[model samples]
Target chain A: MKIGQFEKINDFEWRLPRETQPGMRVPVVVFASERMLNEALQDRSLEQAANAAALPGLRGNVCVMPDVHQGYGFPIGGVAAADYETGVISPGAIGYDINCGVRLLCSTLPLQDVKTAITDFTAALYHACPSGVGGRGIVALKARELKAVCEQGSGWALKNGYATAGDIETTEDSGCMEGADMEAVSSRALERGVDQAGSLGAGNHFIEIDLVAEVFDSAAALAMGIHQGNLALQIHSGSRGFGHQICTDFVQKFQTVARKYQIDLPDRELVCAPLKSPEGQQYLAAMRCAANYAFCNRQLLGHSARMVFERFFPGAHLLNVYDLAHNIGKIESHQFGGEKINVCVHRKGATRAFGPDHPALPARFQKTGQPVLVPGSMGTESWVLAGTAAAMEKSCGSCSHGAGRVLSRTQAKHQIRGDELRSRLMAEGIYVQAGSLGGLAEEAPQAYKDINAVIACIEGAGLGRRIARLTPLAVIKG
Target chain B: MDANRPFSGFAEVPHTADIALDVFAPNLEELFINAAKGLYHILGIRKGTKEVENIHISMVAEDREGLMVSLLNELLFHAANNQAGEFISLEINEYQLEADLLMLEKTGQQKEVKAATFNDLVIVQDAEGFHTRIVFDV
Candidate 1:
């Protein structure tokens, strides 16, 4: 677990061969600059990546993104594919916040037109979008209605008039996963989901208004409806308590299941069952329910945000650019060892950066690529990148999700004052609304790696190409 | 309040993204109580003024680690429902846990913990006491 142990494949790629660890079934391929590689060594992320390599029926290699940080059993910003029929599905590998992802909404309003009204605009959003710990949503659903939301996802929103047809077209999987089973979801998860739709949960989740500072690929930018100097809104949230409970319930159950399957993992958190097993199917069905719940959750949040924008700018419209999941397990076909195979790709803190002409992408993006949203740390520049064909060949069409954390929350809170940070951001012309100053302190920009460097590594590795860069105008956080 | 006594305690541990806690106690029951306190600490919770509500829970798990995760997740479920529990009493025998909790209406909380994870979780008995590190998805 040191920088020297990795065999340098290039400036942006390194390989920890399978021989480095006894139980590993595949090599761990990490995409990072030398500096980022050093950062990965600071935590147990590389070790965790190696641990992930040992999962049964693993295919190709375990790919680690530049933004990786140590997460429970699997490193955040990691991707691993396992054979569909023979491999295993791990809840820990997918993460607790199932389908935690980002959605970018583009607007026609120029930053210059809304610069003076940011404070009120942010306040309006803060009010319209319920946030903070244990904050309820705009409407609480009955158990029966919650089940529909779980099964229908954003389609449920479309039926209820919260989403437009265009929104569904732009969403990944049309905002619904096909195999979600209400029977597989626990009643406890349904109870937790009852009042959580349309909410922006706390802990690294936020709603930000940004100025499209620059466009690198005008064609891709235009395709995504993002114009330079215009404003865009990004929503970062997930399935809320519903997903957490499902993952908790499954990860606990899978411990016994793993033993039953004779799967010996290096860590208990990495417990898993064969993808073909009844236990695996049940977890997949349950996980899909949470994933669909998250899609609907974001759709509702987007609807609320659009209402706020319309109220502020009268005729303004916030159009969906693209919505993609950062944490998910998808059965995808990819070339492995010169043969195409269906594998379950688990992306934790990684986005699916599908290249141009990929059939999964909507027709509008066929000429360009799927838009990959990478939100930087607070007050930093976020990037909208286009997926590249090279990504399919090299990293299983995966890319970094965000500027990963470097400092612990406690360390950040100890080193930075939330009030001072807010004042400083305001002085810099970035309006800020947060639930607690203490919470704000924990998300200080200094706590994360340099986003620009992370983006550079992505481009260098040919995983994604920049389309536009966005600078924050206002931020609302839980 | 007695659960927050001297022989058992918890402290925050450094984790890159999530919050982690190292809890230590002289025995298994104390360890579970201290872990609950650690969760509340990570939440930055303060006691409420409402009348206390008593809750009783009984759970069976595959092992001690499973039992610990079940306990913390139960506490998290209660916290999400607006009732933050203070441990009234806890008993651990084999892989089963039975506990009585005094629940307080959640009044002030500065943070949110998604769930407690079993990542690298192992209860070790050493010369000092029982020690384990629990990582909470934030």
Candidate 2:
């Protein structure tokens, strides 16, 4: 009968005090506008955030971005910094969609030109890119080859002639995370990833043709090589079954090890061991493999996008603007209370928005902050945001991933008709190559919060600043 | 029994007053019922339970896969955060696979709606178990 109590901190922040829930090691900080907060509270993500704070070895605060929503263990759009030496690693925190991320590619083509051949373009992309259940890709690797991918990530794609150096430069961690152990990865996971290396699986994953619709920060936009009306390709996917298997393997393995270490956990799903512990090391190793796999996955997809574009506009240039990972955990150094602590930053359904000057960002754009690419759902608008100093100083350089889902897929499907949605998309002059009409209905543009609003909130909250807006001209979905 | 009798055994269908098991011949209906039963099983809905509070729950999916994702999300909602009211079961006002799901319901007398974890979901195929984590925030 009563509502969960949450204290308003400021216009953009709220706190769930530790005392409100048992086993809370620190408070939970939520970044949201009041209007967004009302929608956020409609679900249990805030509660999940509070639950995550109770996690052992959690330092600072459990941070939930403006796009917060309920997820498996750690809420999507949730960030938690765990002590490297003693804290635990949750597969739930990293998510089944390990490094399930977004990549933006800028092209020399203009929106009007692309719009004229939307149908042809969508069909070409759909045929070129495999999607949906059993979505087999064009690339395949043997065990040793797959291991190389795990180690080199996007770099592997480039070396194998699947990607270019430019694609690597624009990617987070340059498309690689060192210390990946193939032996640590299960064979089943390896096999699952082998044929699926470059495929785009179903459920919200899409390859969209978009045009820069708006620009909020021209200088940042220029730095990122984005311009109004310039066509772009956005790819959204992850490690697929390989990543899922890794999470499953580690969650079970970590749970056993957690008990061995006598780690007291409020939730079993939050099972983890000290980062330096054998269990922790194994997870980080395996997670790195999955992370790299995801990077490679996107890189290969980028190559596919390039091929698709090349077919349409021969000799045209399509450079990757950036690739950002939304679900991951990494060991990074941060200054907390004036002391630099090496913390394992867990970002679930959240983007790492490292500000300008952070050494981790690419050298050229180091002064312009990391490019935070937020992909909107099919038929909607996407935004390019630059990381902010405040985000670096406060939230461990994180920002909202996208316009969080506002409607359930069922609700979207029920309220919308796939045929009607197709007609509507056609009416908007956008061509869609959908695997299923029902699936199309579920991804209706209305199922999400306004991207403009969400992007505005991120900029308003000082987590990130908008650079450019992307409007879909054509979409290919699994 | 006809070929389509026990619906495709994936999900349970919604019943009036209490959760009922519908024997359908195809997986389509089975999956639909499975969705309903999955929700009912989490809520443990019963008509005799007093209506303590009213909760409006709506879910969206991009397709059948997304529908499964959303259905799992509703189950997660019931399990982890259903404390605001009792566990009055779900009334499937509308249900379509890969399309949409609408549930008209009330908060029942159950004191707790448990948070369903991936570990709680056991997928058995050919006597082998595969673990999966479902993201169900619609």
Candidate 3:
């Protein structure tokens, strides 16, 4: 638990041996600079990462991204793969917000065209997408339609006119996950999800209009349809109450299920069941339902942004770039310990970054790689990166998700006034619209780590390569 | 309002992303009730003038911490369902709590409590009363 305790693997990576803990089944690897490692040493995230290594049937090493932070049992930017046939699946590992992810869209409008109208533009965008305490959703589903959404995901949005075929083609897993069972989802979860589709939930969720500041790799940026100085849209949200309730119900049930299976856990939040067990199957089915719902949720949100852009600049096109999930568990095949094995890789605040040669890449990205969208805090520079095969070899094909939090919300609120923060951002030409000022203050840029450093850690470690950089022009928050 | 007694229990515990509370009471029942009030306190709720509706609630859990999570989540779910509250007449016997939660149709809640979590959660008995730390995923 000290900075000196970790053994350096290179200039950008460190490792804690399996012997670090009594029950650890594998070692823990962390990607960070020396300074970033000092910051993590100040918290308990590394301990949680080691605790995660203790999970049953864990495969390979537990990898922690540079933006790692303390979370519930597992660190936020942590990835762990477990043998599918024998590894246990824990809802906690995937996180409470199932499939919480980011979507990037490119617009044809130039930044100068919307400069004077930025305030009205942000307000219109806020109204276009519902958010905040009293915010309702844009789409309400009937019982039958809800079932179809649970089954079809973005395909449902396409049928409902909220998505285009091009958007579907750019989405990960094509915006729909297989093996989701509506019957496994509880009625309460369904009811909660029915009216909340397309809503941007509070706490670290937002819709940001950014200007592509620079491009590190022209080929990758072109493949992603991102041009320098043009406007782009980033929607950060998830399944809302739907996913939270499912995780709650499952994590609670797994407490006893863990007991039934005689699995010992360091923390109750790490409760899990073997992959082949009935309990795991039911939870996976239910988790997939939430994941699909989230996919459709982002699709509708993107639709709303598209309309806003079209209205402002006639004939303006807002095309999908790519969408990827951070908080999720996927069954993937990877080479580990000298062999290719199937494992359930749980990425909590970490993104899937498959290299160019992977079969999962779209034809357009085969020569570049999967685009990794890392949205920085408001008023900071966001990053666009691509997956590297080094990620596949070192960390189960995963990379950092965002500029992770460094301060508590209460501390952040105490640091500055919401109005003052708004004025500061406005002075920088970043138009801001928030449903709640207190909520706004809590997400101040000072609350997060320097994203540039996190990106450097990724590139220096060879896990991901920077493709482009984006600076915010407008922000809508819940 | 308690005309004869002061409201004295529970304090906020700082968490990086979520809301956490440390509740203390003279007994198990009071601890459960204090936990609920602390949750509403964090929500910054403003009660309405409508008549209160008495809601019956009952459940059992394996231990004190389990029961605590169950009780707090029950209130959180009610809040998400748009039912505002001041829960009363709480009783506890061997890890089971029975109470009538007073719910109002209208109340302005400034914050949303997503769900209670079991992360680093614990309930312990001391000479003064019961103590536990609860984290809510906001």
Candidate 4:
């Protein structure tokens, strides 16, 4: 696995042809600059992407984004589609936290109006948004109630007065997947889900308040309710323990099932079962339950955030911008080889950036394309982009999630002490609320690659169009 | 704290987006116990002053790797879902692990690890007895 072995498709695209890997069924198309590609070569991201290409009945080339990094079995920014009839669905490929995604909410208040209230506002947000390690959620639900949440997603949030009507409309799949089977979820997973319904779990998840720093395209930015100097909130969370348990249960189950089907996987973590198999259906049902749970989870957090804004600034209001999932396996129809075919697209650290006019997009966004939320690492410029028609033909309607980690937790700690990092960030006018200083150290901005460059690569690869850039003013992390 | 002292069984390993731990123990039982302690350490579990009762946990896996994941996940389950319990003792065989977790009031937990992943996970025996690497999704 070397950069020299890859064929440069363009400035932002590289390819490891089928001949480059032993069992690769299709080529591994990497969307990155030469520098980013070299960085990816330092890890096993390309190798994992090739392994993903080796999966059974894979349709399109395994696509790796510019912000690529080594993940468990597949590259973090890898996207692969497998035939619905003959493909395989692996829990490992979809990641442990199902539907771990980001939501952007633009506020009516401007930063200058709230500048003096940031400290109190951030503290209020931290208090309202229950975060950190211990409790994943504040609302405890009974088995029956939990089942309803799993089925209805953000709808349950709306019924419970935790979400607005516009919130559901702006969310992916309207914040609920249709096929979530309550019976498919295990008791252990349900127990894990009970207490963590509206909580923000630790590790890379956060709540950030930012102002629309720079607008690349005012039309698209206005379409997304992102205006320069306006406050926007980014809620990055997932299904919490609920999704983790679902993935854990399925990954463990698929271990034996993969052997049962005699699937020759390069890595054990890449273990999978046929998409049409009993095991696959069971996992998909359970996964959808987790996905829906995540959708509801973020909505509840949004409710908490809204409460903070209302309490802090009397007239502050918010409108849901967009909510999108970064890690998921979805059955979608795509133009493949001149035919419309159904394929299960597995996105681990990738996002669905369906182009404008895509039938699946919400009516309001059809003209502007789906809003792509890329919340960069703490204290950096996050991005809001629009999915393009070019993305649909190239990268399976996918784009980079964010600036992927470049340093390990231990390495990050060795580089800077958490308290010092916090103080430094505070001195720079960025309010910080973290559960643990050590945890904060691991998420330092330098631990990640250059996000602006990653976004540029995404644009260069024609996966997305620049819309708005956000600069962090305050952050609450668990 | 004395009971926890002199117990250097595992060390934190570097992972990009998750928590990874490397456990080294003389046998299967120690490996299981050390792995649990490693997870609790990562979670920053704080034990209460008084113990209430003994909670028994049992898990079975097809292999050592699976067994290790099950035991760690079992600890995570109790940590996340249950209001009480800190692992105090662990006993293990080839394929099964049994442990007694102490439950008490006012127990505090800092981090909740979601699950143990099988990504590049392996338990290999060597001259140092047995060593294993586990990745946790937080």
Candidate 5:
């Protein structure tokens, strides 16, 4: 509950021993600076992390990133690996926005080349991509088409001419998770998915036009198609209402399932079902449907942005850099304790940062490692980092998602006026377009921790290595 | 909106990453109604000019918390479909809940809430009334 209670493992590593918390199966390993550790103690994040460690059949330790903050049941920037055979899977751990992730598309056009058209470009993108509360997508899907999206993910996008081969190749898991059974999804979730394939829902989701400010590693940047002074686009969203419904359905159902299994948890939100149980398998199958839906959602969004890019600048192309999910549950083989074993890695508000030579990565990134896109708060610097081999050993190939919230939404809204925040951003040469001023105020940069410090902690812990830093030229938020 | 109502009201609470509301009521039905109003407030929803349509909802759950979550999620489902429900009448008995609502089209909404989470959701009844805190994933 306090910073002084943790056992200091190193400058950026601290451990809350299993003995510190009753019923904890493993220690809670937190990566943070002394200041960050204190900041975490300000909230219930540490306690949530300890709760996560108590989950059944946990392996290694519950790894909490520096951007950690209190989430529903588990800490936001938390990673826990459970033995594939005996562990339990909880819907709350993966978050409501199933594959809530980030996608980056780098273009060769330099910022100076598009300086005059920045406003128009931003407006065009806003029109191309639907955003805000209850914003319908570009195309409404029938039930059959929605089913295809649930199973094929970006592959469906490719067939429908909304995605490029390169885009699918660069996406994590090639944009599809296997074993997503359509029958497993509820009709309500299907209805929600039918009309929200490409819409960017409100609350901290955005499409940003960024200028590559600096390149830390030229080779890695080149591999990721990021160049200094050039422009890039970032899409941050998820499976929309579809994922929300699936999670809600499962979390509700799991309540009874947990009782049936006699699994006692500190928080009701942490209710889980055994991995091999029929209920767990059904949830997994349904969760994958939402995951694939999110992958296709990002692809469609990228396609729309690409269309706007082509219309504005003739012959210009938006290349998919790398797309990865921050919130997900995946079966991955890792070196735990001594031998390599398969475990279900649940990353909630965390990104998979597979280092170089990991077999899961594509051949193109075999040497450079997976690109981890860490977007800062609006008007702040976003960073592109490469996964490190050290991450595989220490943090279950996971890193912080973004600058975690330090203030509540109500606090942010009360402190910062939306119009004033917009004016300040405009003065800084960062063009802004938001659905609602109140929503804009809730995501003010002041409400978040220092992103630079978060990245420094990641680097300090060798979880990831910085390759490029990006500054926003324009931002579109919902 | 009903903060002045004796023994039944709702207020926003501070949460790091989501929207949380503290609600209190004299009974289960009042608690459910206050929770619905609190949800709409968080969403910043404004009523549309369209005519209201009447609808009824019936649900059965395992316990009081389950009943509460089911009621809120039912409201959210309608909200997601562009309808905002105004409670007309409500009834509750143990684990079952039934309500009549006047549904109106939602023309303006500022924020989007994903789901209502059960994190630390404990409805407690004391000498004054019943009180609980609900955290919504936004």
Candidate 6:
């Protein structure tokens, strides 16, 4: 049922009345095209966005990007900000795959070179990088060493000869966010992660070899090292079991403290406590650790891919385009309704798209803005976009993470066969590797809302501007 | 007698098993306990063959949807690692959910824990029997 209180601001924007729900100190907004909106309203995401507005110390409107969908507490593609002092932190908002995100690498080789080695290259990647359900990589760590990874993040990979220095520079937050505490992570989480490093865990995580099918912003693309038909690799993964266990641990443990702190919520999934509370602080600390683990996981995997490329091309050069996290929370200063305030921004299934001149941006891209890497489902078109000033004024510089799931896994499995799907991709000149057909079917191209539509909404809503479009030539699914 | 028996998400005529146990309650505590019982029931853990231990576990997700993915993973870990066949009921009155786990082992030996995926469980809302099913690697 519609909440009856929201005002349709435009074809792509809607605003929730602050008074529509009790405990809601701020309004909530959603950005979606008509098509996306129709699909999103079918689930509980909009209601969850409203519920997020009810959280204490919420400043600015709780915002939902075009890819909004049903999730635990905060809807995936939902963004909210809380007062750092009075606000609360909930692990649900950061997600199980903490820092589950995407990274893009630009290769100098053109389509000629890539296609020549296409099958062999894909097979090499499948062999070099571990993927599929419970996939494991080449490196394994024990207890003490795993702690170092959780604590130091991508730097750990750099020091251990897994990732290079340039790689660290190109990643968001240099692939490590501050405030990670290994002590906050449980032994079980550590155990799960030690063997998971450099691996791609299942469920929508993928490594795609793509060709720059089109470049809309030529100058920007040139600056970022792109040529039409050039080869690029995209890695999509996250903290894996480590992040999962941490989020699971906190969600079940935070309940008592939420009640003790008298935090009111419309759903049990939204349970949270004051940001400075013992429970909240602990979650943040642990969340950072997971986020860092994810950064390292991707870094290690990328390094492995780079090695394979180097071995194959021998003379080819590659450079990291960028790495960005889709799920995370951070303290940032923003102008909310004219007042500059410090708030904790929670982005779940949403990408941070900080515009030009944002102090947090790398000195080089500060003029061009952050590179938002949106990985489409395998056998589809991914995108590269840049943050804009419009986003800075709108949803705290955020955009949709990907083409949101259109069909549930059960439905997808019923609709498609893995072998058929693989054959179809191969017919289109795409090479595909997957651990399970059931998994491949579940993440079939048809299962996701149109990625082009999602990107158009982001552009239409002024959150980000398109730069380049990538079409997968080969894919690795975990 | 049939009505009183706990309805497993599995073992239904249709033979499903995402949500193996469906119990009713007017309060929160009972809902959690029944949920735990439902999980153990699916693993086929029985009474008296094992000892119950206080097992502390937790999970987080971007939202509740992801929570289910993490929660089942923990239960699967215990079942695989510690031979925890059934997780005993406990107080869920607080905002957080808590419980004790019971492990059944023929002898102390290493067990393989194959990770659980979202595909393993099915959840459907129903009045008669909440249908469910799970397939373990072992």
- lDDT for each residue of candidate 1 in A281-345, tens digit (9 for 90 to 100): 99999999999999999999999999989989998889999898999999999999899999999
Native interface contacts kept by each candidate, as a fraction: 0.88, 0.08, 0.49, 0.65, 0.88, 0.00
lDDT-based ranking: 1, 5, 3, 4, 6, 2
DockQ numbers for every candidate?
A: 0.83, 0.06, 0.62, 0.57, 0.86, 0.11
TM-score of chain B of 3: 0.88
Give the C-alpha miss distance for residue B44 in model 2, angstroms.
Answer: 25
Candidate 6 lDDT at A52 equals 78
lDDT of 1 by residue, B45-84 (tens): 8779785689899999988999999999998888888888
Off by over 4 Å in 2: A1-4, B1-138
Looking at model 5 chain A, report the run of 10 residues with the lowest lDDT sum: A132-141
Q: Can you write out model 2's per-residue Cα lDDT over A360-442, one digit (the tens) per residue? A: 88876787899998887678888888898999777989998987777765567679998999999889878888876866876
Off by over 4 Å in 4: A136-138, B1-8, B82-94, B98-106
Candidate 5, CAPRI quality class derived from DockQ: high
Cα RMSD, each candidate: 1.8, 12.1, 1.9, 2.7, 1.5, 6.0
lDDT per residue for candidate 5 within A340-459, as digits (tens), equals 988889999999999999999998899999999999998999999999999999999999999999999989999999999999999999999998898899999999999999999999
Q: Is the docking of candidate 2 incorrect, acceptable, medium or high quality?
A: incorrect
lDDT string, candidate 3, A331-427, tens digits: 9999977899999999999999998888988898888889999989888999999999899999999999999888877888889789999999989
lDDT of 1 at A123: 95
Q: Is candidate 3 or candidate 6 better by lDDT?
A: 3
- The i-RMS of every model, in angstroms, reads 0.8, 13.9, 1.4, 1.7, 0.7, 9.6
Candidate 2: Cα lDDT at B34: 56
Provide the lowest-lDDT 10-residue window in model 3 chain A.
A112-121
Better lDDT candidate (1, 4): 1
Candidate 2 chain A has its poorest 10 consecutive residues by lDDT at A1-10
Q: State the local distance difference test value for candidate 6.
A: 0.75
List the candidate 3 regions with Cα displacement exceeding 4 Å.
Answer: B1-8
lDDT string, candidate 4, A1-478, tens digits:
8888999999999989999878899999999999989988887778889888889989979999988888888879999999999999989899988999999999888888878988888888888889987574757788887999999999999998888888999999999999999899998888778888989888889999998888998877777788889999999999888898898888888878988988888887888999999999999999999999999999999988888798788887988999999999999998898998899999999999999999888888898899999888899999999999999988779999999988887799899898998998899889999988888998999899999999989999999999999999998988
